[model samples]
Target: MTTSEHGAVPGLFTLVLHTHLPWLAHHGRWPVGEEWLYQSWSASYLPLVRVLRALAAENRTHLLTLGITPVVAAQLDDPYCLQGMHHWLANWQLRALEAATTRTASGPSPASAPEALRRFGSREHAEAERELVEFDAYWRHGASPVLRELIDGEVIELLGGPLAHPFQPLLHPRLREFALREGLADAGARFAHTPRGIWAPECAYAPGMETDYAAAGVGHFMVDGPSLHGDTALGRPVADSDVIAFGRDLQVSYRVWSPKSGYPGHPAYRDFHTYDHATGLKPARVTGRQVPSADKAPYDPDRADAAIDGHVADFVDTVRKRMRAESERIGRPAHVVAAFDTELFGHWWYEGPEWLARVLRALPAAGVRVGTLSDAVRGGYLGGRVDLPPSSWGSGKDWQVWAGERVADLVQLNNEVVDTALTTVDKALARAAAVGAPTPRNPVADQILRETLLTVSSDWPFMISKDSAADYARYRAHLHAHATREIAAAAAAGRQEQARRLAEGWNRADGLFGALDARRLPVA
Candidate 1:
């Protein structure tokens, strides 16, 4: 255990935002694919970046620890995605204009409908226009340079993760290692810096996983609070390795968003689900859970702004109280980590970014020290070593979400696909070695590995289990599985031409991590 400059402060707070989405490039567009990516980019990423850039201009360093999984990084930097996102932004501007001119029949009177739409359209148009400028300036080329700028400026600490955000604990050892190593390399390729820490997909863990982290040159990662058995006073070294695991402090994190209640559910906030189909905009406030979309009140920016203010102050007070209490209980200053999906702000909860900005500013003013996970580790906010249990941040804080009966078929599918892909790749490597090839960069083998990794991504099973997009999840999982199977079978059967053709097609659709090489897969 160790202490640091924060020993005198009540507690130190670190905000972790895990930014991830499965590879949606060349996938479906509406309802559940690239739309997810672009919507998050325009609503969350753009605004979040705007807020961070503002803070960075003010010279705020270590504002938070941000994890941009390699898969998401690949999309953000892909030429196809950049083009699509630009078009999406332009479409948004067009939608706003349409909304302003389109008459609706739901308002108090016929006259009221036009007035309401005009106001909504005008406001949305300006917001979309601002996002467009931001996109052209910082995001035209890709998100890499923008992200790298923040990283280099020390505005946030970037955390890397596996190539496709696989649930690590359920993955094969060799593949797990390969993904992590490749993912980190991918980050370095984009941002020019390899992250020392990772927001482990799902905050999933298993005993001795820290050894994997240590072997991969990772100094720290995250896990769930329950994995630490609720003793989240500080980051803990795992097992005998020097790798640290920072557990999320549910006490502080749940205050912003939780299952039953959170700031976003407040009536003043924009209703995420209530949409104006005619205009393709959300036009209602969360009047009440029971209120129908038709009966819900129109969203008012002033009310939402007031709600954000109150929530921000309340959150700051919550952190202060939590830190003070934890510090007194532990006989020293404590550390609190609040980890959440980055999309929750600006995407799911419309006012989330504003609330986050206010909270970040208010916390320091209220005397709560803020830092990144790296800062916490270096500041010596570490407790005794702990042998972590197999766990995830999923429901019940266990591996059931990814491996449960609800996804038992998916589990089997993943196993079968991975086995076939690995077997096929291994044979390809052996053939290469036999042919006196000096390098292991087999294109067919690479595509097999790529499709295989995408096949087993934790996102599919999660989406299925959560029922958010079960059919789409199953479709994607099987789509990749089928791709891997066909490619692997073709290669394994000595049908080199057929395998190459299949690989090329899949590569065009699922191509990501251009640097991924099957030959580089770690040997156990």
Candidate 2:
């Protein structure tokens, strides 16, 4: 017989979500900026927050560990972002209104009446208005409150990363410290909770980052196990530091979804691409006999409930088997953490909320205890020493996904931009202090500092790696490059006027990293 019932396991399963988006507000829209924020807010943030709130209301303790990178948090809390998101929701209402007017007057799906449908106050407009009204209320009223409540209640563990979410592994060592230290401080101030852990952007890792983590007062960090230098199975404390490193559990992590294959790709699921251009709602089928996106299909909760039940059963069973085997070898409770991007739920995996809710409810009923990484570590689980290989949860768990030759141009741009940033920081630090003002925690200079951190965000490289919106990545690179180059030039020449102008320009455009101060950088 199995050592557990209902497929419950003897290990800790930490469900982690890394939520990050670059500072896009005040930049542009449609192809970037406000649009990006609204899209993710609608697709991922609102729904994920709702899931957490529901779980919290049920008194689910330590439900999930979430890493909300500093940049995304900045966007969320920014006044401009606050207004823009609200306005975006409002505009969505207006569009729905417009669509309804057109349909009512022109007749639905009629080539002859297409012109009439485009005008105001048409005949078939009420349904579109309703959809918009619901969307606005769900996001503004439902999701926003849940997000704040989850944070304040301490129901979900929050994690942060370097400002603008840079790839620390290859970032300039100096700038890495600049980004992460400032980011943690910002999160603490904004959320009223200090993060002891961080989700390194892109699961990127390099040796010697632990020292920076320690210096920044960070006690723990998460990376793909392979990136730990071989500590794949559990969170391992780095040598000579209280900071702990946890790796992603591939066995269980892969079961739900992977970069290559997962339940999302199942023929029955809705297609992520290919929306009806006219209606902008998905209205097609993935497989031959699959459910069509359009038609009166109103998201049958029963069908979804059954699918979740089956998946949860299989998941619990797998955990039980793993637990028994680990107990035999380790003679104690082994820990497991399955890490994933938060966007996978409502955004990418439409039915992910159902699956998560069911799995969480069933795990405990099955005898497996659900917990976070901190609890497992504090509970006194000992991990054997092992050298983790270099791995990421990216495509192929390798650098080929991001740094491959196809992205040589982007890589070169990063190298140049970072070097410029380092130089800018040094020069700015030397020029002046705020006349006995307290030295900032980050050593990077003002304009030079903010621009540099934003420039190095892992998002640009990640987007380029996936070839998703290469245009946006290119635009972001040049934007930062200009700032980095300009700020350093002004600091070097002691041209306060020019420096202030460039800084102000950046300020108008910069959405995060407001805490960056050049006096923190040590002279080199």
Candidate 3:
């Protein structure tokens, strides 16, 4: 680890925010669809980008490692998504306005109106207005230009993952390699830099996956601490490869968000689940975890600000103490990494972005060194070789969540879909070669692979296991699975016209990554 320049703490801290969501374009828009995308975009992505740009103005570099999965990048840059996002932002402003005026102008008597509701309306309206302007100014084009600014400026290290965020451990080996390469290429095309590290979907991994990383020029990847057997003081070289595996430091990470407690549970923070039905705005504070929504108190920005300050200090102290102790016990400086879903900041925990900003500034002030994961590797934070077992950051820190008994059916469906897709594509290629008309981009085969990848995404199994919108998850998985089967079957027969028609129709609904080519699939 790098020594503190001011003789403060002698350890390193890396914060990784994995940004991803399943492709929701042209899908349903309520409970769990494009709504999910718009909420995260307005709440998390917009604010997070603003925070980074603010810090960048102060000349901060290596602030954090941000993993924007290839599938998400595709949607962010897609014309359809951009148009939809604009509509969402405008609608948000309208809702906020309605909340501010609906009760005062036409509801129950103004004297009987709850002051808390009025306060919420005013605050939300102001925020919505500001966000609308922000969206129009920077995000109207898409997330690419703004994200590219950060990537090119070196404000953060971008981590790229496979197309569609498939859980690699359960994937066929050839498909896994194909997805990784295509995902990296997608990132390269969007940001003009191919990421050297990836936040493996769910931090999922299997032994010997390092050879694939090495082949794709990926220098490092993240895994859960249990996968390292909890000795996570430093990055480790996996097996016999030069690729490094950094494990999340759960001891420190869980301090902010955990199974039992975290700062977001504080009473002053905005309650994520409680909503104002009329305006669809969350108007309550988390007065108590088990408290009923009716009894919850109105959110107070001042109180939440105090909570953020306290939590930031507590987190910095935790990191400092943990690092000092671990460094002593390990006979050297320790490197601590804290990874979380990017959506957690503003979407799940309303005050999370502020807490994050304060923590980033406070850690250095408290003498703890902060940098990206690349800095940790370059500063000699690597330990001896480790042979990892199959692991994920999911429940049990094992593969059970994605391949558990609960999702056995999905596992089987994924297998069948992938096999049919690969076989169909192989035969199509062979036939084309025999006809002396090799094609660079077979629309039918490409759509088959696209649907196949979407069908195998880890999100489906995760949602099914967690039961958080399991029905929607099931619908999406099977929807893509059916598409893959029909498209592949049509192509496998001599029904060229029918295959093209099916592919074209599917393209209108499920299409993302217009650059995806069937030829990119490995032939061996």
Candidate 4:
């Protein structure tokens, strides 16, 4: 209902990058949050940071629309995580060394194994090492300091969300309000910006969640285009909230993760599966042949460079065409926002950075304006009134992926734990509010709030669903359950001392979200 900066707005093309992972520093080693963090750091964060810096150096604006969940942000700042990530980076170099030596030994034409190993220790290699060290330092020293710089620099438009990535639709509706309000308050304090929008976990949307969003002071929210059911695109006000629903532009998003296909599956890219047991690298043909690691072709920068050009050009053409047609059909300027997880670039697809930089630059050259989601809402665009459906931007745009039979128990348990935690916190806060005018700040209430958010994290069930490290997932759920239990015991027994000690322990361990106070809930 309110457009804060309507005059200077450009037609919207939101490039949202959802960034998250479960608590992973002390978890198991592979296939879930820990590995996911390492893989994404190397493949996505490092390179994406490179791309952002490059674009900034050239003064290219509207560079990114990024989402960082609180739990993931917490890990990125943890000292333990910094050490683990550094070791992983060093080990990756060793892996390259092992792969090169084994491949050369089996080659028909001798490869330069010494040359490859030398490259690992060379100046270029040292430079890469230095870059990661600096990047990691930025995150560890205080992610908010660096992240705030990016936001204030106008290089990006930051998006905020619940403390943990929760599927709001299925969450107890009362807690949805609790989560949303606390998330924004925390992010605003850290980043020094009151975000006008939210990237709902999995882009999940339910019909009445808008009230919670409105209560939280979010202006615009996102959902997959299909989730609109039959609604309009620009965005629409939800009841009395003044919060608007901005649907994803499926025309553009489907290029990366669709029902049947995506460019990442192209044979030219490094295969995600079927890594060599001998060399610990993916060196075989992904589709047809049982090509051995030794026989597979080496990665040629030239081939990937050429592919990037073609893909970028194709994307630009596609976007330009879509914008023209959609504008004509709607009889207004169509805002096409294409969103994706930040990890997909460079992490899932090695050549993703090149593709992204090219696409971002190409959009403007082709007369298709690119922007962040908030930019669109600020531009005064409006949608026909309609309610969104219960949907997520998962494999099926439904909850099936996270709530299927395979992971039903985990999902069901998560809902129960989250609901219980919220209920306990609500009661505790109500008592706190009644007894005293309020302390300078309520750290106890904040700790309880922290426990509540950690328990509600979507990552646990998601990790279980992927079937990667179910044990770690189970362990984490139990860990959060313990925290939630601590809150319940403290509230009931009036053992505020025990609650304080446990809260301090979590503070010593994971202190990011432990700074919230329920008394600061926007004056209720």
Worst 10 residues of 2 by lDDT: 104-113
lDDT of 4 by residue, 255-351 (tens): 7655677677655565455454534444332332355444454444455677678778777766667666777777788777777878888767777
lDDT of 2 by residue, 1-524 (tens): 23254454666767888887777876778756678778677657766665676788888778888898877777776767766777765565555455544443222222213342343223224433443454566544333244556767767787878887776766767777777878888778776777888887777666667778999988777777556543345567766566788888677787888657666665545456534344443322233234433331222334555666677788877766666665666677777778888778766766677677777777788777777767777776546543434545577666665678777776777788778767766555444454476644432257677777777677777787888887888788778878878867875677767777777777777735666665555455
TM-score of each: 0.97, 0.84, 0.96, 0.84
For residues 339-419, could you state the per-residue lDDT of candidate 3 as single tens digits? Answer: 899999999998998888878777777788889999999999989999999899999999999999999999999999999
Stronger candidate by TM-score (1 vs 2): 1
lDDT of each: 0.89, 0.66, 0.89, 0.68
For model 2, the stretches where C-alpha displacement exceeds 4 angstroms are: 1-8, 31-33, 93-148, 228-231, 288-305, 389-391, 396-402, 433-444
**Residue 66 of model 3: what lDDT?**
99
Candidates ranked by TM-score = 1, 3, 4, 2
> Between candidates 1 and 4, which one is better according to lDDT?
1
lDDT of 1 by residue, 1-524 (tens): 01232333576899999999999989899899999999999889999999999988888889999999999999998999999999998999998898778765544322226666678778899999999998988898889999999999989999999899999988899999999999999999999999999999999998889999999999999998999999898999899999999999999899988999899999999888887766677767898888877677777899899999999878877887888898888898899999999999999999999888887777777778899999998888999989998899999999889999999999999998888988888888888889785965789999999999999999999998899899999999999999999999899999999999999999998889999988898764
Instruction: Give the distance in Å from residue 31's predicted Cα in candidate 3 to where it truly belongs.
Output: 0.7
User: Ten-residue segment with the worst summed lDDT in candidate 4?
Assistant: 1-10
